[model samples]
Target: MRRSRKGQPVTEIFKQLLCFFLHGTSRHLVFFDTLAKDAGYAAVIESESTSMLSSHSVKRFFRSFRWPRIYLFRHLLQRMFLWRLKLEAPDVVILGIDTMVMDNDEAKVRHGVRPTYKRVKGF
Candidate 1:
């Protein structure tokens, strides 16, 4: 038996996730509205059928929710999965490390803009 009685169902974050993956269209308020309407969010929720968010809200959500966390998670997962599968390989010819001076930044960078060093305190 399905449990009942709640103030309202939570707004569907899962749909937003699926919407991004399956459709691959980034959301504007209009886009989300159209998607929700086509996917029958209009029929399901009488109140919020107009726009899933304001354009400002959509921008905020994209910056806040979608990109920062999920994108990082996906990259980490992809790297780990590739490593596990041994599918990752260095694209360039390999070199043996002799010693010192990573040359993390090349000469093209400004002289004042030295690479950030993890300083220990008081040498």
Candidate 2:
């Protein structure tokens, strides 16, 4: 994995990624290109001393993570979820699980492509 000078704080990166997913827009890394041009998003994520990272930087940041780091992140998230559940103690709780198959026939050269039951190439 390639590492560069730390540009944005991890918190800020998480905020940007969360906002991007919550926006219900295209689920492509290329969306970062459009976001780089969105002043409104910059205003929401940027601070007086720090600016949003470029699309390339964002992509690089994600590419640096490995399976061990991802599993650690998942463990941390699960612990946080349990803490929140204890604090809230709601009468009812609902959990959801879903999977999405992204079609990648046009980009067969990309990694992780495989045949799916949907009769298409995807990841």
Candidate 3:
């Protein structure tokens, strides 16, 4: 566990690992602030005046960076979910399903679609 200037506990390793998505001081997204807020470190980050990065700058570092990889972000998210699942269910094999139906009627060339669901027996 790492702490912010005001002594709030944060997963510093995770934050450093995520820095791979940022290119430079001017090019990045405002994700860290949101992360800090979500992870309960917003107050710590906000109070760090002597830090190299202000709270807003730290959050938006990705927007100004060059050629940040989006795939890395996606992969990190997937792995984080899997890791959390393992931590919560160390000895159990959990299976789950998402039954989400998106409104894709506007798509001109949808890849996969059942013209009609046999189970629903409708259009």
- Model 3 C-alpha RMSD vs. true structure (Å) is 10.1
Candidates sorted by lDDT, descending order?
2, 1, 3
lDDT of 1 by residue, 68-123 (tens): 67888799998897785576565654559775434434345454644444531211
Instruction: Give candidate 1 regions above 4 Å deviation.
Output: 1-11, 24-29, 38-56, 65-71, 83-123
Error of 3 at 76 (Å): 1.2
The digit string of per-residue lDDT tens for model 2 on 11-32 reads 7778788877898788887887
Top candidate on lDDT is: 2
Task: Please write out the lDDT profile of model 3 over residues 74-105, one tens digit for every residue.
Answer: 77889998999878987777689766555566
Higher-ranked by lDDT: 2 or 3: 2
Off by over 4 Å in 2: 1-6, 45-50, 99-123
As a TM-score, model 3 comes out at 0.30
Candidate 3 weakest lDDT stretch, 10 residues: 44-53
For all candidates in order, the CA lDDT equals 0.50, 0.76, 0.48
* Candidate 1 residue pairs that clash: none
Better by TM-score, candidate 3 or 1: 1
